[model samples]
Target: MTMQLAIEVDRADDPRLQAYTSIREKDLTSGHGARFIIEGKVTLETALRRGRFKLGSLFLAKSRLEPLADLLAQVPQDVPIYVAPQDVMDAVAGFPMHRGVLACGIKGDIPSPAEFLSQGIRAAAPSTLLMLSDLSNHDNVGACFRNAAAFGADAVLMDAQCCDPLYRKAIRVSSGASLWLPYAHGGTGMDMVNAAKAEGYEVWAMTPRAGARMLGTLRIPEKLAILLGAEGPGLPDALISAARPVRIPMSSGFDSVNVATAGAITLAHVFGQRT
Candidate 1:
């Protein structure tokens, strides 16, 4: 596809730069979808190698473009490439940048929850799954998805408050696992819990509370939904009380592992013992 350069900016606060800056939750909800921003040379090169998202445009500091010559040659001649002064590029992205190249590409859409669940059942054994409950940080959410994929969790279910898996930062942090791992989000986390139970999944809530069963001793179920909550609060009291609670064995004096780390350890255990 022919790519066209739309605008170039010399300053971060330049009006043309507004679309790329402030890509937080509020901005996304207002309906401005990013055509994927490729920040830094490494990430840009990775995207080029994969060739998944549709390339839109390329931006680079003039000094750095020489090193990327072979990669640039792969681009269609019709694609617009912009050269900017190093100072202007750094200011525009809000950091002293290492990778001078950035590109814009189309962001892919996530499938519906039902579609994701059905796909998971078809792809793998009816096994363990990770369900996130209102985990808001993009980094944490991305890490959880990465761990789930690594440890053979069948899929991920995000509650409504969780960050969008397709968000650029989350996708990057996931190393593109977010694109391949099956996931669906809708309604409250509790609703998903109930639905999993209806599907014969033994839901296990991961918590550090006193009465919870030690994860090591419990008999892992054949079909499981590993429920996790946000870092500070952990799982909701009602949710914990409803599902069988499981706690990871931890050393004394350590408060708790980060939710993503805890999830990785828990999922590894569950996958390890599967019959």
Candidate 2:
């Protein structure tokens, strides 16, 4: 690693460190900015390996320097690395800063959801898509990404009402899966369903409503999109009505599972069929 490429900062309010401040508040309103923070060593490493998102800079505690030396060597020379003492790091981040590693990623030239889907589908023959609707919880959104990746889904499509999958906690909760997963967010759930159908995908909206077909009974399609919604409210009736409704079998008293868990079960089933 080029040790000199790292800059040592002692001030919490340093202008260069502005992006790492008030993380919680910023995560909520950040939108799809050109820059976003990636926390922890694993997420940073995943971001580096994926190379889909450009890395702007790295912020690390001095203690983390020696441990991450090998990984840091892979960073582009143009990107600056900022090192600070743990106390100063905590002060700057307005939190414990326990992970001791952070990176600013650049979301350059984001494509429209349709474009993303088309490109991903072309790259994978038996494509699978994980779709989310009105999922406000960051944990659930992140878990969904992790499940999608684990099950070999080609990409994810999120409705405009869903929370940002790139949010810091979401990234962490996903165990860095969000760093590599190709996903598009915005537009209504119906828009995504229609787009997938147009692309020759058989859309399956997961629901526990009465009369929905059992997931095990259906055959996996060459191109499939599994739509999952937030818990409690679940998917909108109109949206569910628009696609093939599928449900996981539950005991007599239970009808549904956590949205992410439900996604995992459905995606796993799809993966099993492919194998």
Candidate 3:
């Protein structure tokens, strides 16, 4: 792809930079429509490389242009690259904007849960799937994605109660994994589990409740869905009853683990089983 000319913005309030204004505030607001902000060079590079959405624009600190030259050269000619001095960049972001690399992406279309489950169906072996329910914390959600991707999960599925994985902090926390990992978000927790079952996946509901099966005892299924829930209440009893309840055996004093940590351990086990 031909590299686009980098536009220099001397003023922080340049109209061309409207999408980037008050960025930290916008990250918390639900007014973005189809737009989402990507922070730092690593996440931006992921978007440019494998992200499903089309990049609307890139806002960079002047000093970042040279260091990111190799990666920036791959930008599509239609995407504008805006370069501003450090002070101006910080003024627009409403914070320090320390990473100095930011970009806007237009979320065009997301696959439905059924559509996501259909992936890799014809292959000899099914890919692992990670499902989340009511995980409101962005950091936990991001860490779950990072763990899922690290363990080679094919996709992530989140119920309606889960926070948006595209949220700026979540994406950054995922180390850009959210940018490339295929995910479907919507419907109730049971809806996700039911869909996976229809696709021939054995659903494993992760919980630490009494009588739950130990993670080590079961053989990994060719098509498996590992379901995780919020930290405090854990999965709803009704949802847990709908799937096989499984738990990571902990010490005598502890009955639970952080949702994200549980996910990593579970996924890592399934990964080990496969190898």
Candidate 4:
């Protein structure tokens, strides 16, 4: 196999790998707007191959290189690839990284949530969209991304309060679909609902509170956009009042479902209807 351009670094303090240092899940938000860290071999490989994000650098454990030879070969020679021992890797990240794979990436000209939703509106064909608000959990957002990709949602629209899908844990939990799927962020819950409505979309707010149209018999719209709020106290009253509220059928006594699981079921139902 062709060799990859990988540089071996001796210490965690190496200046060349500044981007990959001190990596903790919560503290990594500083890179959300521009750069992100890709963990695990699959996530790193997918991020590089998709070209959705600019790969700034790579850090690898000595043991992982041979297994990841093919993916490594695909990385740009100009991009600095650093290999270090797992001890230093754990120290830099503040935890043991059993997978021994990590890469740093910077986002490019991806559109904002409102902008992407607008494009879907202008398109000739019907579009499937998922929107989220105040979803602060990375795992939930990651699972949502995976579900969207699996169900072929065109794009994900999230509000300013939603967790970053590119967060390392989210990216990993998503099995790397977080890098594969196209997503954008902006606005408030009400603002997003209004945007969807103005663009000729029938915004379906997923909620369990009173006044929700049961999702079972609800007709999926030709131009559909699903809006979801964070777990617990889902879509606010004003947003619900502005959009058509829908609820998944469950036995009596349940207040709600996991946001990601609900999204998956709803996306599948919408896909079946639209198709």
- List TM-score per model, in order: 0.74, 0.95, 0.95, 0.92
lDDT tens digits, residues 5-63, model 4?
67888788778877777778535546565778888877877887774777888888878
The sequence of per-residue lDDT tens digits that candidate 1 reaches over residues 1-275 is 42333345566665544434544443356533656565656556656666456666777777876677777766766556766777877766656655676666676565445446545464455588899998988789889988998898878888777877766677667766665666887668777787778777899999998788998898877788999999899888988987998888788866579999999999888778873
TM-score of 1: 0.74
- Per-residue lDDT tens digits of candidate 2, residues 9-84? 9999999998888776787676647777899988998987874788888999999998898899888888899999
Which structure is stronger by TM-score: 2 or 4? 2
For residue 224, give model 1's deviation from the true position in Å. Answer: 2.8
Q: Worst ten-residue run, lDDT, model 4?
A: 25-34
With a 3 Å backbone cut-off (N, CA, C), the pairs that clash in candidate 3 are none
Q: Positional deviation of 65 in candidate 1, in angstroms?
A: 3.3
Residue 131 in model 4: lDDT: 91
Model 2 regions lying over 4 Å from their true place: 1-4, 29-32, 118-120
A best-first ranking of the candidates according to their lDDT comes to 3, 2, 4, 1
- Cα RMSD for predicted model 1: 4.4
Give me candidate 3's TM-score against the actual structure.
0.95
Candidate 1 segments whose C-alpha is farther than 4 A from its true place:
1-34, 45-55, 69-83, 112-115, 118-122, 166-169, 252-255
Clashing pairs in 2: none
